[model samples]
Target: MASTETVKVKVEFGGGTELLLAPPQDKRHSLTLPRKDAAGTETNVTFLIEYIRKNLITEREELFVDGDSVRPGILVLINNSDWELEGEGDYVLQDGDEVVFISTLHGG
Candidate 1:
């Protein structure tokens, strides 16, 4: 089994909302965010990429976008560059890297 490690993710919203979301206590490989628009909705984001391998070997890996049950609109960015525009699940994350998730807000 791979030794679990914790990664700090700073989640920010376009509407000036920010939070320091961490992985679950038991599994240091997943992140979950609550759905703001959907009442009582939750989303689970996981880190399946080989973080340690990438750090030791290559500096980049194809990024993947994944979440739990919720279907909220999310925009992932690294160093202010949009990951989707670059190619969904094709970006690389590094040590001490900053990953930001921006939630989409919908109104009547």
Candidate 2:
């Protein structure tokens, strides 16, 4: 039998994105997210983005979030591929999938 309940995923940070979080800059996270949201919608990268901001980021939320999606300069990679190729925020998560947030923004 198959299950749509897979929840374990690996989240990673890069290109100074880690610094946006609290001290220690752990750089990686192992999380067990809900397969379906409270509204019974399947969880996706958009959900994961909010989850990181709410659960992991302790400050500078503007640097990480722009509304419900990541800030413009942040690139989201799902399983090493660009998120645009994987349905952006609608990509359904699978067990053991790796998600990476890399900041390509810099101040002059």
Candidate 3:
């Protein structure tokens, strides 16, 4: 039988993205996700992004997610590598992986 272990990943927000979370200062999040969803598919970045938006974000959800993906100008990195190089939202999450979001947008 396959072990239905959870994957623990570290997620961080920066470059003004932290404002979406509570206190507007807390930026680091350690998350655990089931290895597979109810459909038996492995958890991916797309799922994690929504999970964070729904569960962790305290405000400004639009600043983080849009139309099933992260809004433009928000840079995502997986394990210190560019998410673009890691297949973007299709990249399957692994235990101990580090995901980071940095918003390039700034208030006027």
Q: Give the TM-score of candidate 3.
A: 0.91
Residues 13-82 of candidate 3: C-alpha lDDT, one tens digit per residue: 9998887887746789888898987888899999999898888788879988998899999999999999
lDDT of each: 0.35, 0.91, 0.89
Q: Evaluated with TM-score, which candidate comes out highest? A: 2
Off by over 4 Å in 1: 1-72, 85-87
Query: Better model by lDDT, 1 or 2?
Result: 2
The residue-by-residue lDDT of candidate 1 on 29-72, one tens digit each, is 23222222134322112331223222211321122222321124
- Clash count in backbone of candidate 1: 2
Candidate 3, 108: how far from true, in Å? 3.2
Candidate 2 lDDT score at position 47: 94
lDDT at residue 57 of model 3 (Cα atoms): 83
Backbone clash tally (model 2): 0
Clashes of 3: 0
The order of the candidates by TM-score, greatest first, is 2, 3, 1
